[model samples]
Each structure stands twice: as structure tokens, then as C-alpha cells.
Target: MSPSWEDESAAVIAQGLRRRGFLTAAGLAATAALVAGRPERAHAAVSGSRAMPYPFTLGIASGDPLSTAVVLWTRLAPSPFEVDGGMATDSFPVQWVVAEDASMATVVRRGTALAHAEYAHSVHVDVGGLRPDREYWYQFRCGPHLSGVGRTRTAPAPGAHLDHLDLVVASCQSLGAGWYHAWKDAASEPADLVYFAGDYIYEYATDATSVRWPYTPSLPADFTRQTDTLGRFRQQYGLYKSDPDLQEAHRVSPWMVTWDDHEVFNDYDAEDPSLYQLRANAYRAFWEHMPLRSPQRPSGYTARMYRQLDYGDLARFHVIDARQYKTGQLPGSTVGDTAERRDPSRQILGTAQEAWLLDSLGSGATTWDVMANTVLFSRLDSDDTAGERFSTGQWDAYQAAQQRVIDTVAAKDAGGFVVLTGDIHRNYHLNVLKDFEDPDSAVVGVEFAGTSISSGRDGGETDSGLEVRTRANPHLVSADLRRGYLRCRISHDVWTTQVRAIDRISTLDYRAWTSHTLVTEPRRPGLQVS
Candidate 1:
């Protein structure tokens, strides 16, 4: 006989209570040491013992892959929910090995990194000197406990001839909304790398209407309120990382990650000094959880997130930071087009980033120049009435900045410029026009906006407002309201994008399918429905 829903819920709640109690006790004991200013002793050898709990609860990940290097990451969290992760203030040496095979018999590179308590015992080992465009298996050991093996690959040598590259684009995975069945499906794909555009963790408080609960019956105490402090943000990441499907996705392939507004607050800007401390805390936690190199680490509230990744001469991924340095949104009706929205001084990428992007695009090195963007690049009209409507949170809000980018792409004649976007919890395929207002404007590029992994719970095949919105914006070719990611196959001649979607996310037993296949060619900016 199966357990009833009430019984299952009760069990989950009980587990949360037990974990919370343990965290309270551990926190109190650590407070005394902190107050006394006692120095923490380094435990160089706390091997697997009966007294010590297993520390790889949050799983392991790899990201920021280069031609000869990749970053391997793991956090020591025996009790992930605790503020200290049930760890003492002492640091521990973690041994890491990269193997040619899944079995540990054939080893290539090995090193030991010290996991410090200041960074929540998270270890980021930036392994270098590996062969380019090769697969490598890595694992971690502290004392006697061994972590689950993770697979990562280095990028191809620069300008090396490559036939094809497979990548998965995903974003906006709100833990409380639904289960991550989409991520499980993504892990099964033949992907070289995964680009997590943004919104890795939502900052909203616990939702009463959550469809599924993995760890607890409701959100834990730290996650019951909006995530503002470092401790709360860490707890949020712990909960999100605990998902088996998410962990599997991370374990399978290298990831390229960036942040959206939800990582800090909903529609936040960097101009406000009052929110700088909060932003600082959020940025620090983001770095600790992700598999990023030290150069991308946060210094106070600022971090350099925009960078370029090359896949031989086949493709170039321009990982963009659209939110970090942007000016605040214009004050007025959110949907209505106002004069302030067109102000030249209202910047999105700011001066330095804009210059970098333009210069990178000018470098005609690769066949495909892909933008790993967070928000929609094409203008989206939300209101279909006589008056025009636009989202202030998107590129449409900063018309001058958008125009500059479009002009640069046209002037440079960038090859097959494609933008992979997330954040809006719906899929859209649109032709990026030189001027959104001109219906006959030349198509400068194409944008494939992927839906969320599980943001809006159990979304349908099509939204009610899809027809009106698509009609208002002629550049938009297709739209789907479902929870999933995009599988992109890139070659020198053509680029294909499969809009993969799951039937439902409310239940574990869900079906995934390719809803649409869109293709584009180099120097041919428009998308063709395949």
C-alpha cells in the first residue's frame, strides 16, 4: 500500500524540523568560539570515520571550461541547511583527481585544495594543462569519503576546424514551483556544454501553492523570507542543489553560468547604495555555489561576468551580463512606451561592457556568434491594443543601447549571430530586426528565447495571450508556454535549435518532446521553421 499525501507531507515536515533543531544547536556552539575570537585549527586529515558524516550532500559540478582548463567545484556540507553546513570553523584539504576513464584506474591530473570555512567550505579547483577538446572525469576525496564522479570537457583549440557542437540552454528554475524533470531530460541529451543563462535561484519567499516539496513540507526557516543575507542565499542554493535531477545535469557536462534579477531581487539595479550591502552578500553566495574560476569571483557587490568562450572556429559564445551594470528602469507605465525609455544615457550594458561586446563582434573569427543572454533581445509587445506596449525590464526599455548593439552587428556583418535567452517563462522564436518599429526592417540576427525549467507550475501548450502578442510583434515566429530548455546543434553552415518541452512538471512522471525545430544559416539572419 502506498503512503497517503498527508502522511508523506508529515514525514517531510518532520525531517525539516529535525534538521532545523540540529542547525540551531550547532550555530549556538559556534557562536561562543566566534565571540571569544578563537582561531580555527586546520584539520588536514579528517578521514572517513564513524563519527564524521558524509560531506558531499550537495553534489559536485564543473564549469567555465577553457581550451586547456576547467573549474571543478564541490561544497563540504554534511548538513547543508545549517549556516555553517554542520562544519567546524577549521579548513580541510580535499583531494581531487582527473581521470581519462570513469574508473579511477587511468588518472591524468591530481591536486588538493583547502576548503575554507569563510567560503562555506566550497572548493573550486581550476585544473589546467589538460589537452584541448577532450573528455575528463573528476572526483573529490576528503579523508575516506569519495564524491560522485563528474564529467567535463575542455574547449577545442582556438581556430581549430570543428564540424558540429551540441549545447543546452536553460534558466529560471524556481525550486518551490515544481520538480526539475526538465533538467533530468536535459542531462540525457548529447550536449557538449550547458549554458544556464540566469535565475539559478529565485529570491521570492516560499509559495503556499507549491506543486512539489523535495526536502521539506514547506520552505525552511532561512528560505521562509526573501533571500537578502548571505546565510539565506546559501540555504537557498543548498536546497536547489539537493535536487537529484539538477545534480545529475551538473555531473554530466560543463556549465557556463550567469545571473539574472532574481539572484538578488526582482528588477534590481546597481545604482542604489542602500542595496549595495545586500547585493554584496548575494554576489558572494552566488560565487560560492557556482563552478566559476577565481577571476569571476565577487569583490564587494561587483563581479566581472561578461566573457567569451570559443568552440574552435565553429562557434563563439559571448556570455553577456545584461543586469549587473544597467541603469534603473524608467518610472512610468511598465507596458506603455515612454520618452524616457529612449534616453541615450539610459544604459543596459554600460560603457565598458558595450565596448567589449562591440569589439568582440568586430573580430570575425567564428562562423556563429552566440549571445548567452538573460532577457529577450527582440522587442516584445505585451499589450495588443491601439497603443504600443513594451516591458521596461527588457531590451525594449533601453532603446538606444539596443539600437547600438543592432547597428554594430550589422556594420560588422557578424556571422550567424544568434541569441539564446531565458527569464520570461515562455518559449519564443523571433527574427531580430534592425528596427523593431519597421516591419520591413532587415533581419540582423535571430533569437531563441527558452522557457523556464520549472518556474510557472504545469504550464500549458500555449498561453492565452500568445496570439495577441505574436500578432502585435510580427518578428515573432512562434511561442510556447511550457517548462523546458533548448537543445542547439551548431555547424559551420547551419544552426538548428530544438525547442524541447515537458508535458507537465507537477508530477515526477512527465514526458518531454521537441515542440519545434528552427534553423538559421550563416549570414542569413532570418529563421526557417524546420
Candidate 2:
């Protein structure tokens, strides 16, 4: 009973979170009144309703952006696989709206926020004054049911710069391995954010070569594909948010997620104390279905997912959190390029997130410095004749913590250091070497690994181990295996990346293409073939 965020102090929680301005709206209504008044601990259970039901299934979302503010979300789960989702320990009130025209006809803000069944009836809502590189449009109501109209944006007025930044770097999907049409063509592009980078949900289930339709419904024989407790990880994120192409790409854009190794377990680490209450129920169901804010919610197994999001002077996103203070992987080598897996006190982004990512890549006030990485940070040498067998679950098992981020991007000559990766499921285009066993090393930046939306089930558009893994790794430069996503287009010189493939994820008629585009310049550090 001593943990309601156990007596603060991390310097009074970073000086009361630097005077609460993050995710604004009064710091998410003071974290929804500290998780709806705790209810004598064990959070997730609240009551005081006035009758309600059609609780906007798991739809709408928006996240962590801030030039002004943004953090809307939803989850009253009207029977989202029962247990507690079919809500009852009540407390609805919900009502949110934040238009700037999408036929929402101009109103700017609206609020009400408190759909707590402790937290399962989720509802973040950090919205603020807005208008900082704007493009709003939001929705949610809870008693006249109206939840689907999302599209968010805001984050480019900080240092104010010039021109593009259309992101969309996805990750592993795995809902029985197919169908989401690359998240419905990245939610009909016109993108302006969506980094993702993790497996999103896949604590193992649907085997026997399943292949679709909510994994062919008919569960509850104590259904288990290894999701230990917390009501089977909130019924596996209410069956992957009951996919409507991943809830229409979280209802059209505005995401910046993080989390890998199937959200928990697949590679579990957090200095395991017998899986610390299964990483506090997988970080409280990944902060009750992410649209994160309130300093990345989850306080039980400590969840302060690495932060940083600036687009003003044109990019500065350090969003790293490589498996919550990583340390395991190095035993029977499931991908650990040995040599004691390059141990420099073995750790990945851990020591205070590698000193807040080398003080935000040596604070070179943005001109591109992206790094929303999850796994794979360059070198994938299987037999490049040297770095001996790589992989140990990425950054080739922390080679001196990936060479202290390539010697701090070569001693802060930073020069636009891009690195948006995702766990290995396909697509590549490497060239991030400041060492990788030096094959004339010193290319120091560029990595674009994305390729998985619908894990690896229907792949193939060139693969037979891609010409011996790009001829024993010559900094790879193109290697696709199918199912897609990865479309960046930053400007102020160049950063074009467009792999975007999708010949099939097993029907739903979503045939996309563009199988290879690359390009890098901005102080040039490799990769090009536009």
C-alpha cells in the first residue's frame, strides 16, 4: 500500500515536472485527479455514473505533440472483451471536441474529461490553446455516442522554420499476421506524423497458422498465447483495437509511439524482479492504450517513456526507450553478435536514457535529428565477414551502447542524424557506421528499417536472403521483404525515404507500391537512389 507513486522525490519528480506544462490542459486535469482518486490503491475501478453504455469502442487517438499541446484519446470500451472493459464501476462524462474545421465548423476547444473506471475507461485529453502549426479536428462524446473524427497536428512553432516534415514510419503488426493494408495506406497519406516503431501488440497468440478474422473468433477456453495477467493485457488491447485498419490508422495520423518486444515478455527486462508484476501489467496496459501524456502515465513499474518532440526549426525527436532499461539478451545468441556482445558495461539507452540521448544530440537546434528508434540501429551483419553474427535484439546488442551513439554523432558535428527504425521484419537501407567493424567506417548517420505492419506472414518482393544480405553487408542500401510503411520527406536539403509496399496482406484489396526510393543529403552521410 505504499505505492501511489511512492513519495515523489526524483528531485520532487523533476521539480514537479518543471512546473507542469507538458501535455498542458492543466497537466491533463492533474493526471485525471491522480488516477481518479486512487480508490485506495490497485488502480482501475471507479464509480459514480448516471447510466451510460455505447462507450465509443476503442477508436479515436492523438498523442504527445506539443507546440501548444495535443493528447486526446478514448476507451470506454463498450464490451471490449468484457472483464472490466464492459465498464461498470462507473464515472463517465467524457465530452471532448477540438475543431479548426473538418466540418466541425470551427469551434476551437471543448472539454469535460473523466471517463474513469479508474483508468480502463480511459480518456487522456491534454488539449490546449493550440494553433502552432495547426490542423485540428477531434471528437468524443459519451451519451449520444459520437466517437470518430480524429486527425491532429501541432508542433512547428517552437523555433519556427521552413518547409516539410511528412512522417509515417510504422512497425510490426502480427494480429495473426496479416490484413491492415499497411494501415490502410498509412491512413490515406498527407501525413504529418506517425512514428510508432514497436510491435504494438503481440504477446503471442493465434498460432496454428491462423491468418485473420479476429484470429477466427471463438475464444475464452481460457485463451492464452502467453499474455500473463491484467486480464490478459486488457484482452490483448481489446483485440488490437478491433482493427478497422488499426482503427483507421488511429483515425488518421498524429501518433509518436514507442515500445518493443511485444510490449512486454518477448524480451522482458526492467531488471526483472520476477517480472515485476509482469511489468506492472505491461505498463498498465500501455498507459491504457496510448495517446500518451501526463509524462507518459504508468507509475507502477515506472513508465516515463523517453520524451522529446520538436519540429520548429525542422525536426528534433529523440523518442528512444529501448525496452525499458535493457540488459538481458546475450545468452544463446538469438541475435547477439558476440565479443561478449560488445560490453561497455552492457546497457542500451539506460543510464538515464543515455543522458537524455546525449543531451538531445548535442542540442544543435534542429535541422533534422530524428531518432524514434525501437530496435535495429544500423549494422545487421550476419556474415559481413567480421562484426560476427549481429542482432542480439538490436544496436547489435549494445556495442558500447552503439558506440555512445556513434561518438555523439561524431562529436556533435551532428549534421541531421536520422534513425527511425522498427524491429526486424523487413525493409532496410542502412549506412549508419562510425565503426561497424570499420569497412572504411565513418558514415555516421542514416537508418530507415521500417517494414512490418502485419508482421511476417505474406511477404516476398525479393528475398532469398536478399543477395546474401546485401552481399555481406555493404551498409545495405535497399532490402525489402514486403508488407510495408516508411515514408518520410523532410526538407531543408533532403531526406526522402519511401519504401511503401503491399502486394498482399491476404486480401482487403489494398495493393500499394513504390518498392524503393531512398536519398539522404543534409550533410550527406550515405544512402541514395531516388
Candidate 3:
């Protein structure tokens, strides 16, 4: 996967990922994949161009959840999700405001929105009344440009019992796989909200294992589209919305995203062909460059991505969709094959997002129940490691709907549960036991599972029998495959967590302490990492 990553482009792979990050996201994602993957690049970027430019040049974001209000995204760059930064800014009808005072002089909400370069001109409002857990500041405009002021907060009152929360949980990044400096050390820690939980960018069909920093962009980079075009899915979502450390970690924080399968590729399966027409152009370029949720808008290739978010009583996230409703990869799973990796009716969140996570955990209000889904929900018996052996991508290939969601949250009494997760690169901490056929019936929940902030496994050279398969998975408590991420400090009776990591992902003066912490308590049971 090297020969100059065959057909590379997207401004020379985001200027070599702005200059090295973490083994450049799987060595430049095997060279930004897809030389028409042996004949797939035809749809000719679905025509209809010309339009872009206004108060959107890749900036603004915020996604804190439940304490209510916080989901402000912006796009309209038309040239940064992958390509085509040419024309059309829908005659500039963009204006968005929110503030606890970032100098808008006491403004709390302002209007006028429209960055429609056919979605490439992104804009995800979801503002909502505000005042739940304070600390806000925002920006966005068009007529004379404005964006570049973001900081978000709200979510400290579903049961109110706060003392601390500072969160963070990232996942596979890839825009050339490097220099997000683990999101610049999670925007210098002291977090408030960051749960990315998915491979943000990676649609390129073939870049031949991009040998150490080399996918010279000019075509589409990684938006994936040899055919089924819509201007090559807005030029691969304007090359990952022109990365500026994923736009300064989405301008600092207010994110709770959940898309896993490289946003729209890896392990995909809406109906089949494992990425049916590249999942209709990566779901219309992932709701046209993030900040989504007007019901997952994206007209060209259809996108409805499931939803859920809450964090006031301290957590109730339960977010899922595991790549647009599943039901694939399990039919004779490959790689290292452990009898096709323990396939018990293989699935990953299907059956209506698993009955909306059992009616959102039987309609609970909040006091901790987070699951912000995307691969790795614990119980990894990863045999020879690869595919299967538990992991048809995640929730252990939906084993009878993940044991009916761990036997109905260990037959209910539920309260401070935790799942978190992100694809398997490394870093775990489990205790979520609950009758994997009773080796001891209840332990209930808790499962951090992060790692891979500049993405890819460098964990000092893999196989340590995978750190003894995380103590042979009896509700693992530690697995440090290494890389970094997963902060959680919450409190109100131990939320603790740590697993930060960073002797180096790139650097922003990082020291990122607490390589392990765990804790968990509230609806009480197993989990204690320290």
C-alpha cells in the first residue's frame, strides 16, 4: 500500500496532516485508498457546482449534551471537506449567536442561518433555550465574516450532584493520521465535553498504505466515491472539512458525535456490498461536514444517523447507530478466524438501534447512564486479533442483541452506568459483568475503552498476548495497548477515570497524567482500576 498512495490528493493529504500526528492515521490510511477500487469512481461528483464562501471557512462547534443546549456547528467552506472551494455561499444568509458573553454584549441567542452550499456549507444549530449548566460563548456570520470564538457548556442538572466532570474520549482521526496532537492534548485539558467516538474522516478508497507521510492530494483524498457521485461527495466532504486539528477539535468542545465506521466506510452495511455505493457518498458527506442533527440532514446520499445525548444528572448519553443500522459482517468473519469470531447471530445495534437502547434504559432521567456508542463496549475476548473472535466491529457483534443489553442492565436497578468506547486501537477498563452465562450473575456496568488519538496502533509493537487478553476478559479492568485519551473526572461518588496518555501524540506541551484510574460507582458493582 505505498507507491505514492496511488492517486493521492486533497491538498497533498491535508499538507501531510499539517505535518505528522500519529503514524499518520494508519500510515496515511493505506494511501487514502481507492484507485476507483478496481472500478468504482464514476458517478462524476453528481454535478451542480459553483457556490461557497461566507461566514463559513471551516469553524465553530459545540456539543455538550442534556444539561440542555449546545450543538452549534458551521460549514459553508465548500472547499474544505475534500475539494471544490469554488463558488456558492447561498447569497450569504448566515448568522448564529449564543453567549454568556464572548463580547456579543449579553446576547443569549441570535438568529438568521443559511450556509447552504448544498450542505457542504455546513450548519448544525440545535441551540435550545440555554441556562442549564452555564459557561457559553459562540459566533458565526456571513456578510463580513466572524466565526472563531467557541467554548461550550451545559449539562449539570438531570439530578444535580456535581463536583467535577471534565470529560474527553476521542477515537480514530486519520486525515493523514497525525498531528491532532491528540486534539492538541484535548485542548489543554480541563475538559467540559468531547466524546468524538468514531473515525472522523477516512473515505479514501486506496492510498496504498501511505508509507509514512505521502498521499499528495489533488483528486478526492478520502471522501470515497468512484461512482455514486454528487461532485464526488462534495469532494470528499471538503477533505475532512480542511483539518485545523479537526478545526481546533471543533473549535474547542461541544462535541458528542457518534459515527464509527470511518464516518461512512469501514465495516459499513446498510443493506450490503459492504458500503453500498459508498454508503450513498458517505451519507451525503456526513451530513455535509458535521454539526449535524436536523434529523441528520443530507439530501444527496441520505443520512439520518441515530441520536441521543444527556449529561446533566451527570450522564445519560446512550448514543448509537453503529454506522447507519447494521446486520452484516458476521457471515464467516475473516482475519485470524476464531470460528468466524464467535458469531452468535452477528449484528451491531440493529433491530431499531436495539429497541432504542431498551427504551432508553426504560426511560431513566439521569444520574449517569452514558453509552455514546461506536465500537468496543467491553467483553473483548480478541483471540488472534483481527476481525471476529468477538467484534463484528462492536458490541461483540450484537450477540443476541448483546445479551439483551447485558441482561437488561443486569436486571435493572440501574444508575451510573458507563460505556464510552471507540474502535479497538487500545486502552480499556471494564467491570461490566452480568451473567456471560453466570460466572457470577451481577457486576452491572462500567467500561471506558478509549485510545488512538492520532489513531493507529504503535503501542510499542502490539501482541503482548494483547496484554494477556486483558486478563482473559473477565470484565477486564485494564488493557493499556497505548496511544491515549479518556479523561472523565466526574465525581458525586466516584466517576474517577483517567487513561489520558501522551508521552507524545505530537505535542502542545503535553504531560497528560493519570495513565489509569477507573473507579465507577452510583448504581454500584465492579470496576476500580486505580
Candidate that scores best on TM-score: 1
Q: On residues 146-166, what C-alpha lDDT tens digit does candidate 2 reach at each position?
A: 555678888877889849888
Q: Across residues 1-530, which tens digit of lDDT does each residue of candidate 3 receive?
A: 41211122222223332221211233133224311111111110111222223324455677745566667887655334344445454545777777675444467787887756665556778888887778887766554334555778878656666666788887876645444556656676537878888887665543445322333344444433332355665665555544445666676677777677766656666666544556777677666666666777655445656666655455667777666666666654423434434455555666776877877873556667777777776566666343335545666656566777877776666776777877776777777777554446677787777877765533532466676576456667677666767777776577887777765543234454666677878767578766
Model 2, runs deviating above 4 Å? 1-49, 53-71, 78-84, 87-94, 97-108, 111-129, 133-153, 158-234, 238-255, 258-310, 314-366, 380-387, 392-414, 418-440, 446-530
Which scores greater on lDDT, model 1 or model 3? Answer: 1
Best by lDDT: 1
Task: List runs of model 3 lying over 4 Å from the truth.
Answer: 1-60, 64-84, 87-98, 101-104, 107-132, 135-137, 141-152, 155-234, 238-253, 268-313, 316-331, 334-371, 376-391, 395-415, 420-433, 446-530
Candidate 3, run of 10 with poorest lDDT: 38-47
Candidate 3 lDDT (Cα, 0 to 1): 0.61
lDDT of 2 at 503: 82
- Would you list the rank order by lDDT, best first? 1, 2, 3
Q: Estimate each model's TM-score.
A: 0.90, 0.35, 0.34
Candidate 2 local distance difference test against the native: 0.74
RMSD of each: 9.1, 19.5, 20.6
